[model samples]
Target: MLADTATIVARLTEFLGPDSVVADPVQMGSYLNEPRKRFHEKAAAVALPRSVAEVQALTRFAFEHGVALIPQGGNTGLVGAQVPLRGDEVIVSLARINALREIDAAAGHMTVEAGMILEEAHRIAEAEGAMFPLWIASQGSARIGGVLSSNAGGVNVLAYGNARELCLGVEAVLADGRLYKGLNALKKDNTGYDLKDLLIGAEGTLGIITAATLKIFPLPAVYETAIVNLASPEAALELFYTMRERAGMRLNAFELVPLIGLDMQMRHGMLDKDPTAGPSPWYALIEISQPKGAKGGLLQAGLEAAFEAQLIDNAVVAESLADRTRMWAFREQMSEVQSREGASIKHDVSVPIAAIPRLIAEGSEAAEALVAGIRAVPFGHMGDGNIHFNFSQPVGADGKTFMAGAQPVHDAVYEVVLRLGGSVSAEHGIGQLKTALLKQVKDPVALEMMRAIKQALDPRGILNPGKMLD
Candidate 1:
């Protein structure tokens, strides 16, 4: 049988003092209230561990008593991975354990505690004349552990790859409180099984990540950014291929935006001014990172070639820092502006780079057929083929009524995604939200392997129980 809330709180308080343990329901609001405000289950307590040793101790007690423990970082996760699944579980927040363990700018690697904020990691790397190039929308609030746990892919994923690729090694506490001291700066070590890769995107079901050694690169000399007007997704695709061919790996971000995004932002006062070159049916926010000591004007040259090929009709290349900032703001605020419009059903899925245009066209048509006047706001990292396909409710429809019909909309979108050989969940890791969907969509053998690995590592099923593999 599981321990009650009082027993859990008293034990946690004994382990980490009264100040670090928050058992009062009213005091635990921040931890309970996730970003989406979707899951409403209350946690028994919130344990803030200050060091690695404290985390191990907490895990030890939870394992012995068969208590569920949820590992949370900044709580900025769109999916409810970092939030409580069961009301009886205790939340372990890593916000206080943030610290830099080691750094070597010349070596191009740094070891940081899991709780370190991603934006702070960027600043630290910048101070050393280098950069940790994983740029995500929630970098300001997302912590290193949570980012790695989710294997987060941000805008710059086209150039820098995701969190799993950026990390060289990680230190974690296993389900039974045994420390897995895997922290290292090795670029290659084919000695044994790739344990680091297994734990990264596991959503904390296997273990609690404590620290990681992350890759860093030399800071870029200049960023060439532009918002190019396109006729449709086809034009944007052609433009993407052209720019990538010209810039190669330097082409970092290629984001797609619809005209509806701009209109909604304008209607809700989200942007200071229009950032695109007038208006068009579609827009592609493309950026190229030029290293120090390299010649500039690659983006401009590529754009001229694209114009010649008739891939883009008009474009606005950012001439100043403010211009670049505003252009990025337009892309970053795509998700936020949807809330102002009304109820929205969102899907973060990815497909092969070649199939993006078809995915958008067919998916939108299918959704429109399902719900008349459902505004399809499909936009995101076009360079990497991960579109945050979302649909806003009809202008005059009731929010609750539209949301009630969300399952059909989701089914329609996922059908198109799967038919085009795409993924159901791209950047957001499966928390409690998509467990059943995972079972249905994932391969049978793959699920078996995952279960075996979970059982081997977390026999007690104490670390982030009822998550990922549910």
Candidate 2:
């Protein structure tokens, strides 16, 4: 039998201390309120363990009593992974366990506790003249543990890989309270099985990540940025190919933005001034990093080549630091400006690099067919073929009414993604939001393998119950 709310709270308080437990629902707002505001189930209590020993004790107690524990970090996740699925579960927050364990700047690696904020990690690495290349919108509040658990893929994924690639090792506590100390700085290890890779993207269904050894790089000398005008997704694809062939690995980011995004941001007063050269149907934000002893102007030359090939007509390269900041601000704020417009239906899906144009055209057509005047605002890491395909309600439509019919819109988009041999989720993991969708679309054999692994690691289903596989 499962434990009740009072029992769960009392057990947590006894394992840790009264100071580490929050039993009052009114004071648990921060832990319950996720970014999307979709999941509303209240947790039994919030446990803030200060060290690994405390975490192990709490887990052992929960396991013995058959209590469900949800591991959370920073509470900034988009899906309901970090929040409670069942109302009686206890949330084990890692916010107070943050600490820098080790750093080897010369060897290009550092180990940090999972509760450390991603922005703070970047600061520490930069202090040692090194850098972590994961750049996401929620880095300010997103913790290292959640970032690795979700296997987040940011804009720089075109050059630097996703969170799984950036991490060399991780330390996690299994469901039975046994610590899996896998932290290492080795570049090559021919082990029996890659358990580190398994836990990184399991969405806490297998184990709770405590700390991670992350890969760092030498600080770049300068970053060349720009916003280029494109006729359509086809033209942007052509430009992306041209830029990649020219800049090669130095190409850091290639993001796609629509003209409607610019208009919305300008109308909402989100931007002080226009960042693009002029109005066009679509725009691409391309950037390249220059290392020490390397000359700049790679972005300018690539744009010049694209112009000559008739792929782009006009562009504005960042001439100063402020220009670069403004250009990035425009790209990163695409999702926020949509909320100001009205209710929005969002999808974080990916397709092959060559099938992006088709994905956009067909997906937009299908959504518009379902809901008239549904403004299709599709934009994201075009370099990696992952687009944040979203739709805004018709002007002056009731927000709640439009959201009520969101399932048909989601079905329309996912159909197109699957038909094009793409993924239903790109950067975001399969949290409670997409559990049914994953079971429906995922291969039968693959799903069986995932379940076997989950059972092997967390036999009691105590770690993050009802997430991912459920």
Candidate 3:
């Protein structure tokens, strides 16, 4: 019983008010254009709900009318979860639902609306002399709902954990508009089923997250940062073990970047100057935090141990604030700089921390064998074993031509990842991009349980239809 586009839009306007609905396709650009320009199906209309009650009302209407509702936040998700897959679906933007309901820095938690910008959440925590450690490249525009929905992992995940761990509870609207008011900030509550965990990473397929109780931490006094040159991913892995043993929880970030990434950034002038020591086959960017009243220089001491073990050769420790910023810029710019090179094949896969070295080595070898002269740019959270395994097109190769042959490369990488007991997706959840891949790689039993959960929660399939399970 799919409703016509005009009928749906008119009904939405009738209840949500004409000003809240965007019926014209052109004005819906902001909602449809995802981080990757890959998903392009036009939404029937974009609904800007201003409150949780409104979101519930809209969900109920869509459920009854048999209109699919795609929950959206800031439209910054790399996967196509927040955008429409089929043209008949409605894009329900939660951007206007932004609100800060409560804050208790000493209690180590804050309650915020889903539409609140991630960076703003950071500011709110900092204002109370605390910190919300969840950080991604798109923090400026990414909203809380999208971040929790994706269960996003950022550079600091080594110390703080991903969104699932960071979130204490969530309040959401079900497919039939019933409110699941689970936004309690208790540190320990094993009362019943973990519904908060389910909705946090469902990619909006299970329910629409309206607001959440997110964990916050005390601000560190200072940070020690460095960029060390490693000979290979194997060396980087060894160095990571050393840093973890030495720094413990203070070791916040351990990122890996290849020589090609630095070269691309240099070629595109993305950085003001090179951050690492010149001409290394691979580099490891490390950072350890110094808490209030704690001594610094732990990282320097650890690096000395690494050098004594012959784990690293040359290193450039950040001498000032500018130096540290530049060092991080080098790691964060890895994804952006790839666009300047040409078409690229990207995979956000993770192996067991021990298998990361083999994963990188074998995956790179396979891709090189697949496309002669293909530039292998494997980099990312070395500590967590989540590599942003990516490959640039061969020099002078047409971008479209290289992208055309991406399927085999993807298959090659996933085969290595799976063989090494790695997940096809690490931090980034499976949206429309990897649903097909998930079907092949995921265990049949696990798949069945996931489908059962979705069917039970969203029987009508009106919430993010044809996503995740499908």
lDDT of 3 by residue, 251-284 (tens): 9999999888898999999999989889999999
**Candidate 1 local lDDT, 375-395, one digit each (tens):** 999999999989999999999
lDDT of each: 0.93, 0.93, 0.92
The 10-residue segment with the lowest total lDDT in model 1: 1-10
Residue-level lDDT of model 2, residues 1-470, one tens digit each, is: 44577877776788689999999999999899998899999888999999999989988887888888899988888889999998988899999988999999999999999999999999999999999999999999999999999999998899999999999999999999999999999879997798999999888888889999999999999999999999999999999999999999999999999999999999999999999998999999999999999987889899999988999999998989999999999999999999899899999999999999999999999999999889999999999999999999999999999999999999999999999999999999888999999999999999999999988988888988889998
Off by over 4 Å in 1: none
lDDT value for model 3: 0.92
| Candidate 1 global CA lDDT score | 0.93
What stretches of model 3 exceed 4 Å from their correct place? none
